[model samples]
Target: MIDKVIITGVSGFVGQNISRYLSECSFDTEMVSLRNSDWKSNLDGIAILHLAGKAHDTKNVSEGSEYFKVNTELTKELFNYFLESNIRDFFYFSSVKAVADEVPEVLFEAVLGNPKSPYGKSKLQGEEYILSKQIPQGKRFFIIRPCMIHGPGNKGNLNLLYNLVNKRIPYPLSAFCNERSFLGIDNLNFLIKEMLQNKNIPSGVYNFSDDEFLSTNELVQIISLVLDRKNNSIAVPKSIINGIAKIGDFVKLPLNSETVQKLTENYRVSNQKIKAAIGIKKLPYTAQQGLEKTIKSFIK
Candidate 1:
């Protein structure tokens, strides 16, 4: 059992939620942010879950260099400090993009990592650093590469979709067909807690995703269900939508090129390894159930 824990990026969405869960379970939790402050010596024997890093910025090209600095360089610094400080466990939250931009039709643990974006490359660099290090006796390290994580308070593209659906705005994405795996916050929390307690989970990389995959249309339906609105989606031809997105890009309109790509892209990550290691068959929530819960939180 972990008595003391240090959570980096505790102010962010996932970090804040996980910290609350740990605190409620009677673990002594300390919040740390990369933006400021020094660590207290009291964290000497604690387990560290590092969640702080530069998220992928879709709009800006220059932010790629910054991603490398914060994601790769900062992680190296923290790992070195943890090794010297006698920390027992170190959990690094990486993204699935580190492995692949678009999950192959048949995903597996041994897939060759070919990251297209700088965000993915930066995370891959961080994972490589951890893998290259020699683990001292009594120390365990984990590199968790979770797919698109969504739940209450998530402020990304998922939230934007929820807002549009909730407001009964017509969706022009029905023509697209893509299946993507999403990680619910509750399931992710369960896996993290399992890692904290289970010593047998080998110190290495693990991929995570929900059991059931949902297409974009299904996701929008779940959002509509949560909002008690009619499931109204138009099957706008792909060519038309693409034209609109192109125009929106130049006009600086709301549904710009980036949003269009996100809606149409398919990223289906596999979580078989994590399930086998943790010895679980199904997560606590279904795709629709988890999504509904997330949407309901926004209404309240």
Candidate 2:
């Protein structure tokens, strides 16, 4: 049984969620920022869950170097500190973007990773640095690559879809057939607890996601069910939808081409390895149930 843990990036979304979840599990957690300050005093015989670093800016306004400075360099700094300490497990939170930006098929950790964005590249750099090191005896390292995460606190793109459904607006891109995977925050919490306790789980790269994949169309239907509204998805043609999304670019409309691709993209991630490592066939919650819970949070 794990006794204590030191977590960085305690204020961010995942950080806040995991901190609270771990506290509920009755584990003592020390929260800290991933700055250049000396954080050794807090590292005395505690596990490390490094969740700090700049997140991807969907607006695309951030500089490329900023990703490296925060995601890559800061990770290296904190990891070096972890290596010097007696921390038993070091969990580095990475993204599926580090493996592949356009996942045309189900993505696994063993595949050739070719991330497209600067954010993905920087995260890949961090993973490589962590793997390049020689871990001390009796210490385990986990490089976690999770897909898009959502829950009550998430007000990202998913919320926009929920809003359209809630307001009874016609969803235009219903015709586009696609499959994407989303990770519920509760399932993520469960995975962390398993990783912390199961010493049988080895140290290496692991991809995290829900057991099943859901398309944007299915997502719309789920929202409609949760809101108890008549489904209003219009089967607009792909050409027309693309044309409107193109116009959205100059007019700054919500359903722009980029967002349309995100909504209709095929980015399915496989969670087989993590489950096998933890000795589980299925997660605690199904994709639909977790999504329904999140949709309810929107109403609250």
Candidate 3:
């Protein structure tokens, strides 16, 4: 029966939505500074939600060590305080990137691999540190690794897809078809409520994702339907698209090798562990349904 909650990083895209949800649910929510130099009065009989961390910079512009300074070091400090406090609930938001860069098959909880980016490595470091700590009988700790989370107010790669469809521009990378998983903010909120209410849910690493995987082609169709337009994407040859992406990388165009890979990748994540722990067979929203809501928000 967790009531009082303290959340860090309440200013982030995901954090803002989470704060609103908690308030509507009648939970006494408090926002804390991630840059707090002292943790003396921060923990009192309340649930702690650690969401402050350096996000992944897609443009490859941020300093590599900054990820460790915030994501790793800050997490270690706050988690240590949580263990000593009277708080019984602690939730750490991690990412699927902590496991692998490319998930050719289904991503599970215990798959070990080398992370390609500093962001993923820093998150993994935080996860390792949390797992090493010992928890008392009543206290609970959760390490959640969510997939590509998107919904209203998400101005990331999904916005790029919306722009292309809204303008009737040709999608050059239509040749590469693959399945990618996404976690809607709606489903994430639902899971958080479950974690707070149900003390039976054990503490461990869990992946958050929607029920089904949606392909890029399906996403394009969904966006076109939402915008009342036709998808004018052409099935450009694979070799030609690769060459174009290479040239774009050198010329600093919109389509680069890394962006191309992100747009068309086979990263499928399985949510069996999370659903099992939550005692459900399906998430609250399907992949296409969640994407439809996100597209509507874009037009709003």
Winning candidate number (lDDT): 2
Q: Could you tell me every candidate's TM-score relative to the true structure?
A: 0.92, 0.96, 0.97
Model 3 poorest 10 in a row by lDDT: 37-46
Enumerate residue pairs that collide in model 2.
Answer: none
lDDT (CA) for every model shown?
A: 0.84, 0.90, 0.88
**On residues 1-300, what C-alpha lDDT tens digit does candidate 3 reach at each position?**
548888899999888888899888888788888676664574575588889999989877999999999999999998988887888899999899999999989999999846999999999999999999889879999998999999999956798888998888977777889999988899999899889888999999999899998889888889999999988888999898899889998999888788889999999999999889989988888888888898899999
What TM-score quantifies how close candidate 1 is to the native fold?
Answer: 0.92
Task: Give the Cα error of residue 224 in candidate 2, in Å.
Answer: 0.9
**Sorted by lDDT, highest first, which candidate order results?**
2, 3, 1
lDDT of 1 by residue, 53-160 (tens): 988877666667898999999999889888877789999998888988776494666787789999999999999999899999899999998888888887456877
Off by over 4 Å in 3: none
Model 2 weakest 10-residue run by lDDT: 36-45
What residue pairs are clashing in model 1?
Answer: none
Of the pair 1 and 3, which is ahead by lDDT? Answer: 3
Candidate 2: where are CA atoms >4 Å away? none
Q: For model 2, how does the per-residue alpha-carbon lDDT over 1-300 read when each residue is reduced to its tens digit? A: 558878889888888999899989988888876563776665654578989988999889999999999999989988898888878899999999998889887898998779899999999999999999999988999999999898897766687898899999998888889998889999999999999988888999999999999999999999999899988999899999899999999999987889899888999999999999999999999999889988889899
